[model samples]
Target: MEGQVVMGLQKLRVMIGSTTAIGLRALARLPHGTRLIGLAASYPVIERWLRALLCVYQPFPDIETATKYIRRFIPAGHEHSDVVSQLKQFADVTRESDYPVLFYLSGYAPGLSRVFDLGGGIGNLFYPYDRELRLPATLRWMVHDLPDKEEIVLQFAQSRHENRIGFSRRMEDASGVDLFIVSGALHYFEDELAVILARLAELPRLVVVNRTPFSRADPIVTTQVGDGYVHACKLHSLAATIAGMEAVGYRLVARWPVHERASRVPLRPDLNDTYWGLFFVLEADRRRRDASL
Candidate 1:
């Protein structure tokens, strides 16, 4: 699987407003034969430093931490925090389940797209489960993102051989599951909200959504603003994303805050952006009785 070759430098520079786009362009432009060699030669120090840096920076991969990181830099509430409130409101709707299947989504990023992260900050949202090493009921763990990011996930999952995470297609060997989650991922889709819902409907039960945006597409992440300026990228407000999910089928199960303080990966500069917010999930048992069974 490969990422899409979309977004030219000028457009991307405006989108992410980062030099990373330029480097990715260079990396992409490199002939396949020499690309690896060129990357190794160019980034030997970066690779080594990252490897060593991983040793020092350790924190629970939980949702609260993610929200903390997001809120650290990007404005969460005021007007921004409305997204979190909507998620909380939705979560309030579901006072039932003790442990529901959790789905986490995030917007697309270059290197970060390759993992099954349920919410942000080294996948902090799912930390309790993974930390406790507990398995989800019926295990409908979801890792949602853009198609390109999902493509990256496919590649990485392939290399990992096998793990219970089951996001890997070969391992999952299935189209849908019990729960579907999208943390930061929901905002990217301004159109075709129905497709995401349809995807959710195919699943068996439960859904969790966190860190998504409402309308006007907040672009939750930051982009280089005018000159040195940085504009917060909009993520879908929780209400809008939930409404869209409801439009396609599926209902909100739970939403609540996992409040956490900001922490840094140190090596993962991307995680440094502050965020702290709610835990949200939506669920519906597969409607097509005995289908995909």
Candidate 2:
């Protein structure tokens, strides 16, 4: 009897999902359907219903609006103790997507001295990468994240007796750094890669953007809800990101898919996409050195 009930519930779930998809598709065919849906999305009641049904909320026009919505739930982001604790588990674990970053870091290790890890939580990648690649003795890795994370990161580093890893609250500290890494955190911000780098007095010669969600469709801001936490993320345009980096004198060295992470917007199957990792280097700097050679 219990086994029958379990199978029945699974069937029911599939039935409901299929029904919802069909209904949404049909509704989209009506005149002014898209406009009506957009207006309905603004209602808090609808938002709650969507959240309950799909585990995703309304698709905001931009990240700022989505961020405002999430703030009502989680004001401090990773600063929340539970979020931090959950993130700490990945400190020493490496994923398949990490190898690409490791490959590039290996090649750059000899000449690399400084690394700015934007939005890196508790120096997660530092420990695992160090274990695998045996980082340079003099390397200085700065983790740029929330001010509240500084203490937690410090404690973790101290416990591990990791002297090379440090914390910073300023993004400008990345100016003229040897390398800048953004792993699993770029979508949360509003700025493009070029815009962020342009603000720095000097750009890092090498940059790695890993575990980021990108879509071929137009940009969409969606909320990601996990156990006890919610975050606003914008699915960036793949072409626009690469073009923006190129316009700023950078070249795409390598790109790879990250199968472990993905994003799916409710009722928008067209916007569904997987995460990716990218590596970029300054073309002008390379050209200068080649010319000198």
Best by lDDT: 2
Candidate 2 structure quality by residue, lDDT tens digits, 39-105: 6657978855654453225467788777776565344455666778767888868878999999887
The C-alpha lDDT values of all candidates are: 0.35, 0.77
CA lDDT of 274 in candidate 2?
87
Model 2: lowest-lDDT 10 consecutive positions: 284-293
Candidate 2 deviant stretches above 4 angstroms: 1-56, 73-76, 286-293
| Estimated TM-score for each candidate | 0.36, 0.78
Q: What local lDDT does model 2 show for residue 240?
A: 84
Off by over 4 Å in 1: 1-128, 136-162, 166-174, 190-194, 199-201, 215-234, 257-286, 289-293
Question: Residue 200's C-alpha lDDT in candidate 1?
Answer: 32
lDDT of 1 by residue, 82-179 (tens): 44334334422422221332233222111121233333222223434443334433343344432333443344435543233333333132234433
